[model samples]
Target: MAPSATAVPATAVPATGTLLRLATAGSVDDGKSTLVGRLLHDTKSVLSDQLAAVERVSRERGLTAADLALLTDGLRAEREQGITIDVAYRYFATARRSFVLADCPGHVQYTRNTVTGSSTADVVVLLVDARKGVLEQTRRHLAVTALLRVPHVVVAVNKIDLVDFSQEVFERVNAEVQQVARELGVEEATAIPVSALDGDNVAERSTRTSWYAGPTLLELLEEIPPSDDPAHEAFRMPVQLVIRPQGAARDEAHRDYRGYAGQVASGVVRLGDEVVVLPSGTRSTVTGIDLGERSLDEAFAPQSVTLRLADEVDISRGDVIAAAADAPVPTQDLEAVVCWLGDAPLRPGQRYLLKHGSRTVQTAVRTINGSLDLDDLHAVPSEALSLNDIGLVSLRLASPVPVEDYATSRRGGSFLLIDAHDGRTVAAGMVGATLPTAADAPTTPEGDEAWDI
Candidate 1:
C-alpha cells in the first residue's frame, strides 16, 4: 500500500491541543472498526508490534492485505465472530488535536453499549453504508445521540468504493440522514463520503474521484469543537467527601480546618461566593479552596478541590454545594427519559435504586408515559420498556434530591437505575424528556452550522 497523502510520521510527537471525545455507531459490517483502524494507522498511532500481529493473522487467514479492523477489535469474541460486542476505546493524536475515540458495536443487541459510549461524547461519528443508504438502525443511533444530547453528529457514508464513489448515492444518503436528524432534534449533523476499507478520503483525500470536494474524515475530526465548556455553566458540585482531620496526630494549622471535597461538576466558584447546600438548604460562604496542598482563591468546573465554607452547616457525602442564587430545587418526583438496558422488561410499580451524581436513593417507577418510535421519531404509549427500549417515565424517589434538567446540564441531570436485588444497572436515565411534547418543540443551539459532505 502506498503512503497516504496526509499520513503522519510514526516518530512525530503528539501535539498538545484540545482533546475531543468521539464515538462511532452504525449497522453491522458498516466498517466502523475498519475506519477506526484506518485513522490509527494513517495517524501513526498504532504500535509496530500490533501492526505485525495484524499482518501475521491476515496471512494465516490467507488474506492479501493486513486487516486493519484488528487494531480496534481486541475482544476474542469479536475477532472470532467478526462483530463488535463491546465498546472499544482508542487514543490517537494529530498535529491539531488529541482524541479519545470509542468504537461502539453496531449490532442491535449492543445498542446499550452504543448509548453508554455516546452518553458523554463531544461528537458521535455515525456510519452508513453507501449501498444500504439509511436503515432502521441508523435512525435508532440518531435517536440515541439526540436523547443523550451529544453535541455533534457526523454521518460517515462508508464503502463509497463499493458504490463506485458516486456522488448521487452520497447525496441521497446524506439527505435522508439530515431529515431524520432534524426530526430527532440533533443539532450538529454532518455527512461525509469515504471508503473506510480502501482509505479513500479518510486521513487524506483520494485521487480516485475528481468530482467530490470536501475535507477528509481526519480533517473534520480535528476541526470539530468540544460540546461544552464546564466553566460556562451554572455552579454545581456534589460533595464526595468531608475532610475533617481528627486525633492528636493532626497539625495545628489543619486542626480547625473543615472542608468539603469534590470535583466541580459545572461553573466556577470563588472565595466569598454564597453557596447553598441541598436537602438541608443551609447557606454558607466560601472561605477557601484547596487543590491538594495548595490553597487557591477560586476553583472552576472539573477541578477536584476541597472547599472551606464559613458556616458549620450539616453536610454529608450525598449533599450538594451549589450556587445560592442558581441552586436547583430539591424534589422527590422526577420526570425522566430512560433507555432500558436490562434483559427483564421495565414496568411501572417496579422498584430500583436511582444513582444521581454522588447520591443514591430508592425509587419506584410511578408511570411509563410513553416509548419513542424510531420510525417517525415520536412518542407512543407503552406499558413496559423492553431491552434497548427508549421511553419517558415518571419516578417517585424516597427522598428529595437536587437534580437539574438534562437539556441544561448533562452532568447534573443524567443518572442510572440499578436493580436492588442484584447489582446490575437496569437503565440509563435523563432527568427530562428528550423528545418533543405539548409544551416543547424540537430545537438546537442558534447558529449557522456547516457540513463538509
Candidate 2:
C-alpha cells in the first residue's frame, strides 16, 4: 500500500508548527454539529462539492436553508432523526495550524462514545445554548472533561443570534459557566458567544456583538500551544512485537537484527540510553532505533519505532521498557474509578481482562468502594456499579504490571476493562488513591468478609 500525503518520515517535523487534537461535546440540541459546521465553513475548509451536497440534502428534506449541521452529522440515522448518535471525526487545516476534531455525541446514552472520543484530546470545546443557560447535560460534559484531564476547555455559548446577540444574556451564561468551571477545578476555560448558524464569533469576530471583545474560537485554538511534555516525562515503551527477519537469504546486518517494536507511550529514548524492562527487572541499552527502512538516532513519546537493544533480554508483548530511574513500580493490586460500560452491573469476584496501553492481562474486582452520584457530586456506598455508573473500585491482577498515578501520568494511569469472553470493553478506569494494607486499617466485620458477587 502507498503512503498517504499526511504520512511523514519518523524524523521529519513540520517547519510551520504543531498539530492540535480537539473534541467537541455538549448536551443534545446544544448546537454541537452547527458549531463544527460553522467553524469549517467560516474557515473556508469546506469545498464547493461539500456545500452542494449539504444544499441538496437540505432541499430533499424540505428545509428552508442549507442545514449546516448536516456536515458533521454523517450518519443517515442521525440525519433522519436530527440528532447526533455517534462520534464523527473531521480533519481540516489552516496556514497557521492543523486540527483533528472529534465531534462527540451529546446524548446521555452515548457517554461511552464521548469518553472514547475525548480520551486523547488536548482541548475540549463544550457548547452551551445561550438561552437555556447551563443544563444537567452541560454539567455532565464538564465533569467528564475534567475527569479525562483535557488540558484546555473552550465554552462556546451558541445561538446568540436567537437571543438578539444580547450582551446581558451572554454575560449571564458566561458567569454561570465560569462558576461551574471553578467548581470543577478547570482553571483554563474560555467563554465565547457564538451564532453557529450565522457563523458569528466562531472563525471571525462577530459584528453583531460590538460590545463584546474577545478572540475568536479559531484564533484562540491556533494560539494555544500543543502539549509535548509527555515526550520529555520519562522513557516508557510497551513492547508490542519482537521482530526478527528469519530466512536463508538474510545475512550480515539483517541476520543479527532483533528489534522490539511499539510506539513510545511516553518520554524520549536515544541510542545507547540505558533502559529497564519492567516486571522482569531486566536491564539493557538502546543500540539503535528503526522506522521502516531508515535508522533514527532518537525517538520520543507517541512515535512508533522499533528498538535494537545491546543485550538479548527476554521481552514480549505486555512488557514495558523504560528508563530505570523513572520506571514505575510493578504491582498486582490497583485502585481506580471506573465508568461501567456493560449492561450488567460490575460485581466483586467477577474476572475481566485489563488492557493498559499495549498490554493486556487478566484482572478481577477485589472490592467496590462506592459509586459517584453525578447530581450531588458525592460518593454513595455501594456493593456493585450498574451500567453507566461511575464508581471507585479495587482490582487484583493475575500478573504484576507497571503503572503510575492517573493524575500524574495519563499514559500510564488509564486502563480499560474488557470482557474476556466477548472482548468487549466493559469499563474505563482511572487509577485512584491506593488503599492501605489490612493491618494498617482497623478491621471490622463488614470489611473482613469477602464481598459476594
Candidate 3:
C-alpha cells in the first residue's frame, strides 16, 4: 500500500491529544517575533486577509519582503516603537501537536512582562541571533528560565541564512549555550540552527543545513512530553464565589442549595472525598459536584465546578479547600523571590496586598535579602528591589495563609504583590523554604531586635 498525503506517520499522533504551553525569550530584534510568525505561517495558521495585510504593511514600510514579525506585534505602540512591550499570546496547531505560545518582550525594561508570560509555561524557547552569537541578554534570559525552573529549554540559533549556513558558527554558539545550561542545572537543553526570516528549520526541515541532523523546532515541540505535575498534586480548589440563585423557582429544589464554586487548581476531587478548608480548618465531605446543570462523579485539575458539602461549614473566597491529608499548613511568614515591576523600588516595611490563588491579604515586606545581578547570575545584597529587578525578600502576612514551597508545587507557591493604594501589581513572588528560628539555628545575631512587619 502507498502512503497518502494526509496519512500520519507511525510515530505521529493526533495534535489535539496533547497540549504544550511554551514561552519564547530573546533580545530585541533577535527575531523572536519573526520566528513565531514563521511558525504560524508555515503551519497554515494565519488567515488569508491577515497574510495580505502583513504584506501590504511590509510594502508600506518599503521592505522588499513581508514583515512576519508584524503578525504578533499587534499593539499600536509596539508597531510604532518596533519593540515588544507586552506579552503577546498566539495559538496554533499541527497534525501532531497543539501549542499555546507566549511571545515575551526582549527589552530589559520588560523583564516583568517576561516573568508574567513564562510563569505558567512548561517549556521555554530561547532564541539567539547567529550573527551576534551569545550576548548579555541571552545569558540573562537563561538565568530567568533557570530560576523559573521550566522543565524544558530549547536554544534556537536563528538567522542561519545570514551566516551563510555555516556549521562551525552553529557549533560554536551551541557549545556556549550548553555551558550556561549546565551551570544552571538544565540537563535537557537542545540547540537547533534555523532562519526564521527564510522559514528554514522552523516548521519544516531545512535543506540548507545539511550538516545538522536534529529535529526541526516544530518536530521537537510535538515530541516533548506534556507536564503531568498538576494532575499528580493533591486536590486544591480555591473558592472564587458562592453559587446561590434566588427567585420564584428558588423553592424546593433550590431551597436546600448551598455550594462553593471555584476552579480546581490541581489533582482530582470526587464525591465523598474528605476536604479541609484553610484558615478556618473546617472539615467537610463532598456530597455533590455540579458543572452547570449536570452533576459529575469526579472533577480533576483545571475544571470549574460547584461543590456541595455534607455539612454546612463556613467557606468563602480567599479560602483554599483540599484533601484533608494533603492540605498545606497556613503560615504568616513567607520567604520568596520577587520580581519587582513597579517604577518605585520595593522598600522594606512597605505594605501591599499579597494575592495567592484566590486569597488576597494585607502583607508587608519584612526584609530584603538580595537582588539578582543578571549579568553574572549572582545575588547582590540590597536594601531594596528596583523595577525589573529580581530579589529575595520575606513577607509578613496579616494572617496565616496556605502556601506550598515552589520546589514542591508551583501553583501553590506563586503569588503577586499589589500596591494597596492604587491596586497595581508591584511584584511577582515565589515562596521559598522558611528560615530557621534562633533556637533551631546554629548561630544567633547579637543585639537582635524583632523585625517589624
Model 2 per-residue lDDT tens digits across residues 1-453: 011122222123233457899999888898999888776766556666777788789899888677889989989999889998899887776668888899989888887888888889999999999989988878777877877788999999998999999999999999988887776667878988888887788887888899878898999999988865788788999999999888874678698788999989899999989999988999999999999999999999889999999999999988999998778999888888787888888887788999997888888788787775666555666778887677778888878889888888888999999999899999988886322121232211234234322
Q: List the pairs of residues colliding in candidate 1.
A: none
Query: For candidate 1, lDDT tens digit of each residue in 231-250?
Result: 99989999999999888746
Q: Which candidate would rank higher by TM-score, 2 or 3?
A: 3
lDDT of each: 0.87, 0.82, 0.83
Ten residues in a row with the worst lDDT in model 2?
Answer: 1-10
Top-TM-score candidate index: 1
Q: Write the per-residue lDDT of candidate 3 for residues 1-453, one digit (tens) a residue.
A: 011123232223335758899999978788999898887777767776787788899999999788889989999999898888899998888877788899999998888888888888988999999989777778777867776778899999999999999999999999988887776557778999999988888978888999999999999999999876586899999999987778885888799899899999999999999999998999999999999999999998899999999988888898998999979999999988787889899877778999999999988777777676655555666777788777778778888999999878889989999988899999988898321111122211122133344
Clashing pairs in 3: none
Better of 2 and 3 by lDDT: 3
Give per-model CA RMSD: 7.2, 5.5, 5.0
Count of clashing residue pairs in every prediction: 0, 0, 0
Task: Indicate the TM-score of model 1.
Answer: 0.93
Tell me the deviation in Å of residue 101 in model 2: 0.2
- Candidate 1: where are CA atoms >4 Å away? 2-15, 436-453
